[model samples]
Target: MSDVRQLLTSLQFADSAFPSGFYTMSHGLEGYRQARLVSADGVQQLLADLLLHSVGPGDATALAAAHRAAADGDIELVQEVDQRLFASKLNAEMRTASVRSGHQLIDLGAELIDQGLLAEYGERVRLRSTPGCQPVAAAVVYAANGVATRQAVASDLFAFSASFVGAALRLRLTDHRQAQAILLQTSPVMEQVTEAALERNLTDLGGFAPMADVMSAQHERAEARLFAS
Candidate 1:
């Protein structure tokens, strides 16, 4: 029964249909497309790089930290993890995308999950005490819902892929079949990244995706865009 609950919670948080505002943000994929730097093959490469370099050491590591902290009833540490992750995001759109999605997730989770911790954290976010990045919000929800930390990180990373692929399909970068292939090929990379992310401490919560940051910054000033980031 506990296993079933965990699976359901993971699925709920990961589902694209969830009102986490995930569909509105492309997470820098739009910038790559506008720059003509992405083909179908490049889509796979970008996802792999993001999983390993950007998302793994940054958001996934923060999620693991927040999960452990929440488990130990340490909300202060969760805020610290969230702030560090926010500071590491070099692009404004990147930070906005994460904070927006995270705020929405916290709002929805607090209403649905009956978790006092989320409510308290939501207050902190309301007070601007924390940036309330997506990973931290995910960690809090997963911990409250009995999902394991590794699974929480994995789910967050997968949700990111789903959002990126959705953007690619809309941008006409890939067809449905090719998008499916991208997800299939990227699954192993996601697994490996998740493993590494789980072993990271809060001090290891930084990323080196210079190109992604540049692209994201460009996206912020684009004349037009299909996605927010």
Candidate 2:
């Protein structure tokens, strides 16, 4: 029964309608589209590359570490993980988007989930003690709700993928059916990426995607923009 409840909690948080502010983010897909570097057919591969290279190594790893810290009641360690993740984000837009979404998640989690750790973490974020990146905030919420570390990491990854595909749909790079197919094709990559994230340590907290970083940096200065990194 407890396991079932945990699964439900994960689902609730992972839902695209849960208002984690992901709808406003293209996760850099719009930047790639604007640069003409990505096509409709290339959407799945681009998403897979991001999961394997960037999100998996960076954000996912931090989530796993933070989850462990939060589960162990080591708020300081969780803060350390959060700070490290924030510092690793290369561009200002990316950093701002993360912290923005994270703030929303932490605040909502505090009100809807557990008021204990979520409230404390929210206070820390308010105090500027931590940057409150989305993954770390998610780790705290999932841990507080008794969700396992692996499930939490995977759930967030899926949410990211969904957001990415949804962005592609809005950008006209792909239609609804194709977007679902892309997500289906990306499942194996998600599993592999999730495992790799679980095995990573705090020191391996950053991703190395030079092209994506370049695109994001360009997007930051574009005269016309539709998404916030």
Candidate 3:
């Protein structure tokens, strides 16, 4: 029964339809497409790079740290993780998107679950006292709801991959089938990233994707963007 509950929680948070607002942000993929810096094949490489450098050591690491903190009933530590992850984002849109999604997750989780810690965290987010990055909020939800740390990270990573692939499809870089192929090929990278994330902590939450950061900064000023950064 515990396993089933964990699976359900993971699925609920990972679902693209969960109103996390993740669909609106491409995390700079749209900027890459607009500059012609990425093509169909390039999408796979870009996703792989993001998985390995950006999301892996950064958000996923924060998520793992936050999950453990939450599991230990350490709300202050979770908030610190959230703030640190937000600082690591580097770009305004990237930070905004993360906090926005994080708030949404917190709001939704407050309604869906009866966890006092989530409510307290949501209040902190609402007060603007903390950055409340997405990974930290997701970790709170997963940990508070009984999802294992590794599985929670894996679910979050998969959701990220899906969002990126969806962006690629909208950019006409890849069709539905090709998008699936990209996702399939990127699974191993996600596993590696999850493993790396699980071994890291808040102090280790930094990303090396300078290009993605540049694209995000550019995307903020792009005259015509189909997606937010």
**Each prediction's Cα RMSD?**
0.9, 0.9, 1.0
- lDDT-wise, the better of 1 and 2 is 2
Q: What range of 10 consecutive residues in model 3 has the weakest lDDT sum?
A: 198-207
Q: Write the residue-wise lDDT of candidate 2 on 102-212 in tens digits.
A: 999998888786557678889999999889999999999999888999999999999999999999999999999998999999999999998999999899889999999
Q: What value of lDDT does candidate 3 attain over all alpha carbons?
A: 0.89
Model 1 Cα shift for residue 211 (angstroms):
0.7
What clash pairs does model 2 have?
none
lDDT per residue, candidate 1, 1-229, as tens digits? 2878887889988998988888998888999999988887789999999889998999999999999998787999989999999999988888998999999989888888788787888999999999999999989988988888888889888898998899899988899999989999999999999999988878888989999888998899999988989
lDDT to native, each model: 0.89, 0.93, 0.89
Ranking by TM-score: 2, 1, 3
Backbone clash total for model 2 is 0
